[model samples]
Structure formats: C-alpha cells, structure tokens
Target: MPPLPAIEQPAAVFVARPGTAGRLGQAVSWRQLMVWPRWVTLAGFAIVVGAVWAVVLGVIAGAVLGVFCIVVSTGTALIRRGLTARRIMRGSLTVATPGMGMASRFGSGALDIAQANGITRLFYDRVRGIHVDRDIVVLRYAQLFIGFPRELFPDWAIELIRAHRAASGTTGYSANIPALPPIPPIEQPDVSMVADPGTAVAMARESFRVTLRSVAILSAIFAVLCLFLGRLLSHDHGLAAGLGLAVITTVWLLASAVRGGPKTRAAYQLSMPPGEPLSARFGSEAFEVRTASARIRHPYAAMTSMRAHGPAMVVRSGGIHVYPRELFPENAITHAGMVNKLLAK
Candidate 1:
C-alpha cells in the first residue's frame, strides 16, 4: 500500500471587513457569558456591593443599588465589545495553516493551535470536532480553542476542512451549519483509559483544599475589616455582637467549604455507581469520559489548566479530571510533557 501524502498548511485567508454596526453586533455576540467563572464573579460582585449598600443606607436603597450595578456592568460590557470590534476592524486579521495545525494572525500577534499528539496535527485526525457557522468556524484542538470568521476562507478551503472532519469518526451534527458529507473511516487512537476510583477522590480532595484555602484567606481579611470598622464606629455592645456573629458565620462557612470536597467526591462516586471503572480518552480534538452506559466529550479548550502533579496529570477546566500515573505508567510522563509543551506555546 502507498503512504498517504501529508496535509500542508493552507495559504493566508483574509477575513472580510464587516460594517461598523455588524462588527459591534459580532462583538456583543462573542461575549464570554458561557464561561462559568464570568457568571460566578459577577454574582460575587453583586453580593458584595449589595451588602455594602444595605449597611450604608437601607434595604430598598441596597436593592436599587444592585440594579444600578447590574445595568452599569451590562453597559460596560457593550462598550468593551465595541472597542474590541473596532480594534479587529482596524487590524489585518488572517488565517493560515503553517503545517497541520491552524494559525491566525491579527496585526502583529498570532496564535498557533494544534492537537497534543506529536505525530498528528488536529486538521488531519478528523476525530477532533469542528463547528462551522455563517459567521465562525470553531475548531477544537487538544489544548486550545480557535474561532475564526467563516467567510475568511474561500469555499475550496471550507470544503477541504469539511473533508478532513468527515473522515474523522465524529458522529455529532450542527444545526446552524450545512450538513457535512460522509467520508471513509480512519483508524482512531485509543485515548481512553480506566481511572482508579481512589485517584478521583484524591483529585477532589486537592481541588477542595485549594478552594477552601482561598475562601479562608478572603474570609479572614473580611472579618478583620469588619472589626476595624466596628472600632472606627461607636463601639456599641449590640454592634460588637453583630460583628462577632458575622465573624462566626464566616468561619463556619469557611470550615464547610473545606469539608465539602470529600462530600462532593463521594457524591461523584455515587453518581458513577461503581459498576465498571471510569474511562477517560484524550482524542485529537477533545477529551472523552466513558462509563458502562454512557460517554461524554469535552473539548480541550474547555479545560483551563493542565499540569503534572507528582505522577498524575491534573486538569482543571470545567471540573477536575485527574489522569494518574498508575493507569498510564508508560505514557503519563509523555502526556504531561506534551500538555506542558502545548501550554507553553
């Protein structure tokens, strides 16, 4: 049998400049609202601001202040979006494939993205998922997210991309984009490895430890501030008791957060039902978690951090996913190196 030719990078593909109104709309639509951390931070901000307002004025004033804060946040987000859009419009944004992976350049800055494996570029694997829409083409690599303008590439380039995706054994469908044509199946690498239940528990514990420490530090700072404020104000007996209660409650909550990690780990174990072992796969484009009855795919971009923790590969993105050395004794080191390399790039 003849060897297949390597897939070379495509030439630079320029994105069409959208009108001012259209650019503004695109900017607003691209907001990171889907990212959980953004929402969590916003909620925290609201709580702190409302509490401060309530203490200064009254309940009604606090409610009004919260509403005003939310409105201001929304407006500020829109303004930032407009600024980003204007920046993109002013710069020359182009996409290219330097090799197997995709690369995009805006003005002087450029982003190079590819899968984790040393042998295969994400574009050739077909196993990694790609989503195409009228406005964007979102490519999922092992460690990065690449969203480029759909109209940036010509029809031929789009067809070539679809061809690669069709060849990959992906079974998903996108409603917003045109349906992809089927292609011959290619052999897929075995990325899935069954993980030890004990490892999962340990990972959960570590995650909780980090969270608890953060909360404890913040709580201590807040308690100190409250005490200082009480001293500054008239040290009434009732006010002192209230401040004492607040400190007690904060300490209690911090303790609970510390204890919650193990409980959460136990809950995860119960949810898994412990019939067969849990298996995880690292594909060209995404990560897959499989159980006896079901499988779930998570894009690599969804993972925020990946690093070597002793003999394990600890990933914290949407949640905690730990790959222990016991499971992949031979490949754990290699996997860690690849992840670190990707992250470094």
Candidate 2:
C-alpha cells in the first residue's frame, strides 16, 4: 500500500472574500423592488380616480384624468428610488445578497451557523448586520435585537467584508453591495431644562394632571349634549340644564379620581444603572414617576399621567389608561403623587 497522507488541522478558520458576479449572474436592479402588489395598488388607484371623475364630469374627461394620473405616478416611484439610492450610498442602508444556489453569484457560496447544537441556514437575500455602535442588530429584514452583546461571528465578519468592499471602489466582488449607513444616535433629553429630581418629577406629574383636566373639560361638552337631550324629552329647558350640570360633575369627579384615564397603553421595561425611577411617555411628552425608593421614566413623553389606584399603577395618556398598577413600586400614594405632578402641567 502507498504511504498514507498526513492530515493537519489549521490554526484558525477564516472566510475568504466573497466573489463577484460572473457573466451568467445578474444583480437585482432598483426596478425589482416594485412587485405585483404595487401594480395592483396602482390599478386600484386608477379605478378610484376614474370613478370620481366620471361622477363629477363625463367619461372622456374622466379617462383623460386617469391617464394623466398614471403617467405622473412613475415620477413618484423615481423620486423614492433616488432617495433610496442616496441613502444607500451614504451607508444608511445595508443590503446582503445571499448565496442563491443556482441563482447565486458563484456555484458554491452557501454557509451555515450553529448555536447550542441547533443550526440555521442563512439565505443570500437575508441581511444580518449590526448598527453603527454594533450594539443593536437588525436581522431578516425588520426584526430588531438589542440588549444582547454583539455576536462574535456575523457582525465582525460582515464588517470585514464591508471594509473590503468599500476599499475596492466599484470593482470588488461585493461592489454592487453598498455598506449600510451607520445607525443614527437616539436623542437624549435636555437636562438643562430640568433643574433637579424635583423638577423632573414635577414636570412629569404636571403633564399628567393637565391631561386629566383636559379630559374633564372635554367630558363637559358631553354634558351639554345630554342637556340638549333632556330638553328634547321634556321641553323644559331648566331640567335639561340641571341634568347637563349633573353629568358634567359626575364626569369631572371620575376624571379627577383616575387622573383623566383610561389613558393609552404603554409597556414598561428597565435598563441599567439599577434603581433608577420608572419613566413613561405619551406621544412627544415625557414624565418620570418617582417614589421614596425608585423612579420611573417615560423617555418618549407618551404618558400624560400615572397614579396608584389600589393595587395597580394607573397610567393615563391623553385620556387612555395604560399598564397594570402592580407593575410599579409598592408604595401607591407616593407613585400617585408623582403621577399627579406629571399631569399637572
């Protein structure tokens, strides 16, 4: 028998640079984004326009308007494409071209990753990359994963490939693939406007209180409607007026008790710097619910008010109620006071 060959294990495994598209392969063009749904939508829009014009004018005028509308639609698509291309060039969007088997750039480019003995097949069209800070990762289109430490394999490898592709100008293997733009930083609150913990808590509480007051005011309008109904029933305007006043008072009392709830629904989660207060936001407005023990913050300003009612923490946004009271700290009175301050403004 011939001498057996010696097999040696390599020190470290590294993926080679991805290859460029060959003469047989074709890159996806900007036009490919427009699909059957787009065509169907366009057709539906045309029919709607045609119907409207026909009702207002005549068949000939309607047909002319519809044609004009369709002709102008292409410009809208072109404008969107221009914006997308600009964003891509600026690294605002990252795209991954998967190894598409027979349709792939090369004959053999498939790869797999394994975790906890489980394996997942990654497709060519799937984009798996990290944002600028390499902190949050967007995977398989729109799914965002944060809090997890940057993965050891995919992000580092993608970055390496991106660097190579960038350096190669427009001629590299992944040249057609533009690097995704870096993720923009999240805006933080301006603390100069905030003097201290009291200010922060007060700002949040007053906001909530004001929201309740507004709801109470709006509920008064309903009372006026009830008074009108009473007049319709009895013809005695005094009775209607009295009923309206009663209804208004009832609504005001209820609104004041609940701090102008039922507010919008909001979910609460805690991050680092343990023991920080709880926060809530109500659509561009922010509030912090503070207790003797801890504070909660609503960074988005989406929560208008938060108060403790019995066992549950009552959060009011606009006029909507949110989240169970049990979710907040146990001291109900303190938290409720904090909420009153937030809504007061």
The candidate scoring highest on lDDT is 1
Best by TM-score: 1
Regions more than 4 Å wrong, model 2: 1-32, 92-140, 143-345
In model 2, what is the error at residue 156, expressed in angstroms? 18
Give the runs in model 1 whose Cα sits over 4 Å from its true position.
Answer: 1-200, 234-246, 258-263, 271-275, 292-294, 308-313, 321-345
Clashes of 1: 3
TM-score of each: 0.36, 0.26
Instruction: Please give the TM-score that candidate 1 achieves against the real structure.
Output: 0.36
Query: How would you encode candidate 1's per-residue C-alpha lDDT over 221-297 as one tens digit per residue?
Result: 65665455445443553246336635654765676676565555653353244344555555544554443322334
- Name the lDDT of candidate 1: 0.44
Q: Report the C-alpha lDDT of model 2 over 1-345, residue by residue, as the tens digit.
A: 111111122112222113312100111114223445666766666577556554544566456545644664566566655654443322211111223111011101112332111112222232333233232222221121111112323443455434433443223444444432211112232211212333333333444555667667756764664455345434544344436444644654565546422221101111111233333222222333322212233422344465554433455542233333433443433444455565433
Per-residue lDDT value at 113 in model 1: 26
